[model samples]
Target chain A: MKGTGCISLASCKEGQTGKVIAVLGDKHVRERLEVLGIRKGTVLMKKVQQMGQGPIIAAVGNLEIAVGFDLARNVIIRVEV
Target chain B: MRVLLTGNPNVGKSAIFSKLTGIDVTTSNYPGTTVEFFSGTMNWKGKTIEIVDVPGIYQLNPEAAAEKVAAQMIATGDVLLNVVDATNLERNLNLTLQLMKIGKPIVMALNMWDETKHKGIQIDVDKLSAILGIKVIPTSGRSGEGISCLADAVLNAKQAPETNWMDKDRWKTIGFIVDKVQNLSGRKHTTIEYIQDLFVNPVLGPVLSCGVLYAAFTGIMRLGKLIEKTVLSAFEKYYSHVILTISKFLGGSGFLHEILIGETGAGGVDFEAAMGVLTTGVYVSFGIVLPYVFLFYLVFGFLEDLGFLPRVAVIFDRLLKKAGLHGFSIIPMFLACGCNVPGILAVRNLETRRERFITAVLTGITIPCMAQTALVMRMVGENDGIFVLLVICTLLTVWCILGLFLKSTVKGITPSLLMEVPPYRLPGINAQLKKIRMRMTCFFKDAMPYVLGGIAFINVLRITGIIKLMGKLAEPLITGVFGLPQDAVLALIIGIIRKDTAVAMLAPLNLNSTQTFVAVIILILYFPCTATFTVLLRELGAVDTIKAVLLMLVTTISAGGLLNLALSTVYTPRGLLITEILIIILVIEILEPVKRAATEKKQ
Candidate 1:
């Protein structure tokens, strides 16, 4: 997990599953993401991504969350082949 | 005794509240529908029990306004009804454990129990109750199962022992309980899951959303018109004829006669055209407005409960960003299309003050409620449909321009969208009907008096000749700038009270097509009625309300003046469309650089 390439969630294509390696943001945003079950080591899959800079829909443990593109780009995830 | 209903977002808290109290508030298939708490009273065991539906939240510490309200409400409640989504027990128990820290008497309602079975999620309710030291009742708020047991359990509720546990300990406790009491078996994918997947499909999402919205709009309009044409007109005709015959028999030219049934028109008594308190007021409210409002709410309630609104938000997310608002902001706009009061109130769901102010102002100015829109169609649609198109296009342009201006100037950040999209479910018919009934009842109880009183007040002004005097007083600007006759001033005055009535009054003024178009545009832009105005003042505060009013005046006058100029020379629908395209391109081009600069500064 440490040596594998880490990519931002925004770079992940639809239907790609990944493990959240780190959530890079301010304390408030990280806490918000934590409460919604997106913490380090949590597995999630990209369900849908709007074209261009639109929001991305991701699934974390049976919950669908729509994340802003800016925030999505900050969530560092390691794609699980 | 006050019993508070609390849960994580979209866990059927509102549904349980509705079931317990027999009072229906809006329950949509999305989080954040209950932005503010709702209260209802019920007589349980011959005691008056007050039930408060607190907005759903994930944790005790709050971020949004709704969560803050819920957190505050927890302290004031005598007992807590911790409703948990049975299908997602592992995730939902996180909130249940948090609520237990408050040390209140908690009666756990395992809601959506039926759905849990469908998804092969089995819960050992008795074991959960014993482990948590509380009574756990398996309830289906949709099907009214175990409701009586829940009611009985509330009376004997006991507080769970408080534990000095940190956040980490709380999660450990939830994990322990979930592992002990819950079991899940693999199940095949259902049709609802398939449809949900299709709705969010990148290419198909936009197309399906447009198709759904178009179908809903046309359904409401067509059904509303059909009801209005057949049943409403027949009832109005018969009632007016009967009233007129009695007035004629009583010698129809006296003061009492005038008060009862104002001056007659070509059709006997012409209730709407004549300004009478008894005849016209009753006719306008019951005959004209009720049909449209009823039909619109019926369709809206169905779609809302069926979990279609969030998908709408998702599809429109990118577009709404251009308006300096979130995709969920469309909920208020859609509600505003029916009426502005609830629409303004719905602004509470937005996270930022800047969004609330911008949305409130744009909605107040440009979005005409159904009553006004109906009248606009009746008056203008008969002459030419293109005029209707022109008026709509003008409003859209003004909306975009104002949104961009506010985005550039407004000081706060527009929070990115992070909304929960609830699973799609077939709405219960009874729930849909109850919602429509509750909303319609609110309309009649709250709004009907204003409609009646407004009409009577206008009649008094007419009887005293003050309306005419004021019309003459404003003649210079009325005739010179907007190209309407002097008497059109009275319609403007009445428009402030009720736009539909004001539009009805315009038929007597005999303005030409372009003048009528300008007049309607001005009417929509000038100000909302007294009902919406009061709500705006309460929501946006005095300073912002004043700013909104000033903005309304400037927007109306400028839009009216410009439209008058355009239509007076070289006006074609094709030309209007081309201009609209150019304006959009120009606005986007101008905003791109500013947006980049703002993001650069933020970084």
Candidate 2:
């Protein structure tokens, strides 16, 4: 699978693996995400995508974290297509 | 010496702390369960050691309230006991590195060690400890493995020497350490992981949650009713005979006799209608209420430990977001169904005061506690099962409408939901039973005084002619607006004390079916029971609690008045039900778009 340039994590299809490129949102949110180990270069597998603009579940290493719609849209990830 | 137990959320810090100190604090599979810290002391090796289970946090700088609390606690601790999840070593180490910078005497426990092996994770504990310059113990907090060694390590813990790693590249240092000490073999998806996936799948997730919750609700109700019928009836039969014998001993009908055994009619001491301190009060508290409470806490404890609540939260996030709440609000709402006190207490878990205020208010207004639900089921269901359904539908509609209203009017932002989803694990039966016992003890302690005192006070008011005076004073509003008789004013008055007892009070009024339906709905929406009232005050403070109570009163009168009008005018129950459903749907349709626009603008 070749790496697609970069896309909003919100658009990542379920079961797709990606490496985080940038987190674009409020500084506090960025810091909070950083604390959860979802900062730049972290590889995440999109596990579950809720219907509509709902929260999405992604795995960082072995830890699974739920990211809300707005925040997930702000997370830029390079997907392996 | 104070030893603070610190770790990332859901890493079993509370489990370890409970094991060490023998204090049965609430431990669950989800993050943020321990919103507040608990301290307990134990005698370790002839020395007293105090262990504090600090609210879990991921980093030391601290942005949230619970994180700030953990940060403050770490500063004052004599020793730091850092618990880490063995399987999620990389992420758990993020907090460990930050804690080591505090320069306190620190020891590390590899919690959930038993799961690591099955998950194909191998950790060289000695190497990790050597590299980090801290005493590391491989311990399973849930299984009580290597706990004594952990305690011994905490006793002899030493400060981890500071390293020269760049602050900007802390993750790099963590990566280096993890690569050195941790090994992973290829593994397939486990059954638990597969179930976790199914719980978050869009289509199946909602179905499963609804199925699980509905099953739990009906299961508890069935078991509770069976116990109430069989065990309580058996006890009531024997106890009534004993009480009737004692009444005859007191000559069967004096002032003291009336106070003790209540009004003894030709049928002897009637437990439900007697209204004496011993007869009705005991039956209302134990026979009517205790079964539901016991069953509720048991099922709730199991769900909480199984890590299913967060999945429910995630599934409901989109709909709840429309109401200006994060999905996590589902947790406290679930708690409130069991009882409102712990439910209100759990509101502190929300990140913003606005979310907390809104959740607390909606919960107080709409969610009837288990005891009240049981009584409502018996009373209204016996009259017309349709009315019971109506009552539930009415409260749910009110809940959604009130939530939307609060979303538009509340002054702060509701932060988006971003939380860790802990994996599922079977709850230990022993720990589950212990938690249920602790909750039952708390319930009885908080409720007994109010239950007995409220009944005693009601008796005094009746005997002293005060109730008659009060009833006459409130007659116009009771009869005119609510369409209830003046006798129902007593139930409304006692409703302020306990809703279950208030519903029981309705039995003696000989209310017709319509009046019963109206009275039950009003009792649910009016004011929270006194026990819940105090908790609301403490949790939300005076100003918010007052606002909540005022909202409750307004909603109660309006809803009650509307129900009376609808029931009296409609020739058919089907028309009434359809009208109620249409009104609910219309309200949601009208309010939802406004909330969405407002949230989008804010974003």
Candidate 3:
């Protein structure tokens, strides 16, 4: 888990579970992600990634959030095997 | 004393607010439903208290307009009733922790408590209260469980002891507290979860959404038509005769009789065609508009509570993106299909002024209310379904073209969709009925006076011969450009008050199919009714409203002219198809340069 490279949450396949490694972007974006429980160490599961780089839907702590494609790309996570 | 109801999105803060205040602010399963604050009064210990239901936000620092409103509202309240979703205590407590730092007296309502147990989640409420240094009352906003205790907690709420935690470290503090007081036993994934998964499954999701929407649309329309024929016609038949008998007893030849019962033709009162306040006004509102509005709201309320809106938003995100709006903007447009006042008001949920303006303008111009649609169906649809289809297609074309035009011209970036897709739950019928009842009450109280008064005002103008003079003045444009009769000007003027009534007025004008189609399109495009106009003025402010109105005027006249020309020459299904294709091509050509420039600017 430590040696494997981290991928952006946007790249995670549907049904993949991951631990958020870091939320990239400015204070505002990070704060938004944090408030929704998507900070470092938070475990999230990818639910749906709409085609054509649409919003990325994921579940974090029983609540599903639809993050825009641009924002989802900044959320780095380590997918569990 | 002002008590602010604050919580993370979709935590039933609105439900709790309604329970405490007896005011019905709309409550929905999805997030961002309450985009503006609603205030109502409640009696606490024999003292009247003012309570405000603030828009839900994930944090104190604002990233959007609704969140900014919530943050501003937080500073003005004497006490904060912090609602937390009991099923998601760990995540919700982050906001609760932030509220504690505001130093306001806070009482926590553990809402959705019933769901927590169902999900195999357990919370030590006493321990949680001790840790946060506040009273924590477990309450179910749906079933009203623990509401009295919540009210007691609110009345006796005390400010927390000063904490050493910094704002930046609040999450850590929340984590620490949640570890001590919350426990989640592993539970099996249920059927609802599977259904939720299917709803967002890119391919099946969109298909299911279309199916659901089609079903809801057909159900609402069919039931509405049924009620209109059965209930509404029956009510109008008896009510008009009763009013007619009374008017006749009172010697029905004077101005008062004209205002009340209207000109009694040979057959009956002629409620629809008559321009009288009592006849057309009552008939339009109660007989025509009320049935459709009721049926639409019932179906819409059920859809809203069932939590399908966000999924619809998800499916329509890319499509709405072309309109320079996020998917959530569709909510307001959907509401507009029922009526435009609440639709215009719902634009507050959008993130930017540009988006709100675009959505409002598009909704006002293109989406006909159920009443207007019903009227068009009865009149034009009876002759040919193709004409009805043409009306819809024309409006859809206008929606797309105008939306793209506004997007390219309006100066703001359309925010991307960042929303919670709540789990689909079966709607509670009792709550749904209550919501419909509340909305109906609001319609009667807020919209009815304007409908009736506007009719009376128009009637007065007609009696004084001013309407005729105005009609003469509007003759060249109304008859010459739109190809409708001069009397249609009166309908156009009355349209500003009520669009359905305006269309109904077309009945007496002896209009052919083309004239009726053109007139209906113009009525839909010209302007929203006076009630909607007032609400839009308040929502978008004066300058934007003026811009929107000007846009509507330009679009309405041009659309009427174009339709008349098309129908008069080369009038065929292929001709309409060609016109639609030309519009799409024109929009694309216009959009390409804008898209290129935007990308260049980004680079």
Candidate 4:
């Protein structure tokens, strides 16, 4: 499973499930994401990504969190095969 | 003893607080609705207990303003009333564990418990209580179930010793606890779930939003007109007769009569032109403005409770990005359409000062309140209606242009949108009415003074000849640059006090359609009214407030000057509109490169 390709959460296709490999950003961005359950090792399913550069939605344990484009770009995830 | 109600955002903490305390605080379906703490007292077992509804936060350690407010509030509480959304038990437990670490006596309310049944979520309340060494009661804020039992538990709740688990990984502990007490039975996708999916679908989302907005607009218009035509007209008929009798007794011509009854004619009081404290004052605030404001809050509260707003925010995030804002900024802009004070207050929810600044400035400079929009429609739109459209479109363009300009120059981080898109639920009619009633009370208390004061101020200006003198003084700018008659200056001056009054003031000027359009645009762009200005100062500090006001001045002058030239030069209104559109395109085209270069330099 770890051998599957890793990609930025922003780059993931809709409906794809992945584990967040790393949350790369400043302390503020990382903390904001973490509180919403987007921390390292948490699995999230890509619900939708609006208009390429728009915010991305991820489903983590029945909760849908919308991550902004810039912040979403910093969320690196490992695609689960 | 003080009990602080705290929870994750959108977890119905506020709803439960309202239930616990019987205080009608604003409760909505979105996060960040309550940015400040509200305290109320409840009597339990003959003891008065103070309950503080702290702003929602996902963690005890805070970053955003609202979260910081919550964190600050937690220290003062004697008991922690942690409200947990039962369906999302695992995530909500993250915050509960953090709260439990404070060593304060804590009671848990498994809120939204009613929904857990339908969603196939089962929680063994007794087991969870035993595991955490706390009382956990199942309650539904919507149904008011188990509230008294929760209150009883809260009163008798004992402090737990500082947990040894605090040294361990918190999420790991939460996972362990949830695993023991929680079970989920798989259920088929429901219609609400399907509608929720449709709301966020990229293509369908925008289309649905348009449909929702159009429906809301027409509903507000139809309802507002119904109230005005039926209730207001009946009110005016009986009201005018009594005031007319008083006018006749006072001889209807003196200064006293002018102050009270205004200029009464054979047809009685023309409330619009009465210029009296009693006549136009009451008419404008209660008759013309109240119905629309009532409807706006009604519709807004419905949409808010339906949990549709966050999805709308998601849809508009991309466009708002150009302005250095995200989709969350839409809430403030939408609220501003009702009034700017609440709009400005909502700015505290924005994470960064930069987003707040842009949202505040754009709202003050461009967005017209519902009252002003209604009056403008009646005052100007009654003639052509196209001019109202022109004014609205021009303000929108300014919002876009000014946003782009401010986004590029302002120094700060534009935090990305990370928010929960709460599931849609039927808006509780009782909660909606309570929210609207509270907001209407605020309108009466806050706005009525300004409306009446503005009318009295205008009458003083009329009596003292100051208005005429000022009109003469501003002739160069008013007549030369804006192409409005000299008398139109008074409207611009009173516009600072109350925008609706300013538009109503234009009614007496009887300007042509072109002049009406130009003047209305300037009125909107010049500055925010007194109430909004005070809030703007408080929300955005003095320095940024001054910057916003200065931007308003520049935007007003340039927009007014350019619009005047275009309207005067173009042969027809259509041509003028085309010129406006062309100018917007040209500005965006020119700024695109500048923005690109700025980004490149930053990289």
Q: In order, what lDDT does every prediction score?
A: 0.82, 0.87, 0.84, 0.87
Considering every candidate listed, which one attains the maximal DockQ? Answer: 2
Report how closely model 2 matches the true complex, as a DockQ value.
0.81
Ranking, lDDT, top scorer first: 2, 4, 3, 1
Q: Name the better of 1 and 2 by DockQ.
A: 2
* Model 4 reproduced share of reference interface contacts: 0.75
lDDT of 1 by residue, B1-603 (tens): 899999988888888998889888888777777887899986778777889999988878887767888999999999999998888786678788888888889999999999987788889999999888899999998988999899888887888876666877665677688889988899898988899878777789889888987787677667767876775568566887777786787697666666666777656767767777677777778776888888878878877787888877877777777878777788788889888988998887787888899889989998998877877877777778877777777888888888877777877878777777777888988888888888899889866777677777777777788988998888877877788888888779877777777787788778888888889989999999888999999989999999999999989888888777777788665587579767876665566667789999999
Q: Candidate 4: deviation at residue B396, Å?
A: 1.2
Off by over 4 Å in 3: A1-5, B40-50, B231-237, B250-254, B581-603
DockQ of each: 0.64, 0.81, 0.71, 0.79
> TM-scores for chain A, candidates in order?
0.91, 0.90, 0.92, 0.91
- What is the per-candidate TM-score for chain B? 0.93, 0.95, 0.93, 0.96
Interface DockQ of candidate 4: 0.79
Q: Model 1 shows how many backbone clashes?
A: 0
| Pairs in steric clash, model 1 | none
State the lDDT of candidate 1 residue by residue for A1-81, as single tens digits: 465757888888888999999999888777677777777777889888886577788898667888878778878899887
> Against the true structure, what is each candidate's TM-score?
0.94, 0.96, 0.93, 0.96
Per-model fnat list: 0.51, 0.81, 0.68, 0.75
Model 4 lDDT tens row, B511-584: 88888888888998999999999999998999999999999999999989988887788557776667667756
Give the lDDT of residue B402 in candidate 4: 88
| Candidate 2 per-residue lDDT over residues B190-299, each given as its tens digit | 88888978999999999989999989988988899988887667756788887888888989777777677778778666788888777888888888789999999999
**Candidate 1 i-RMS:** 1.6
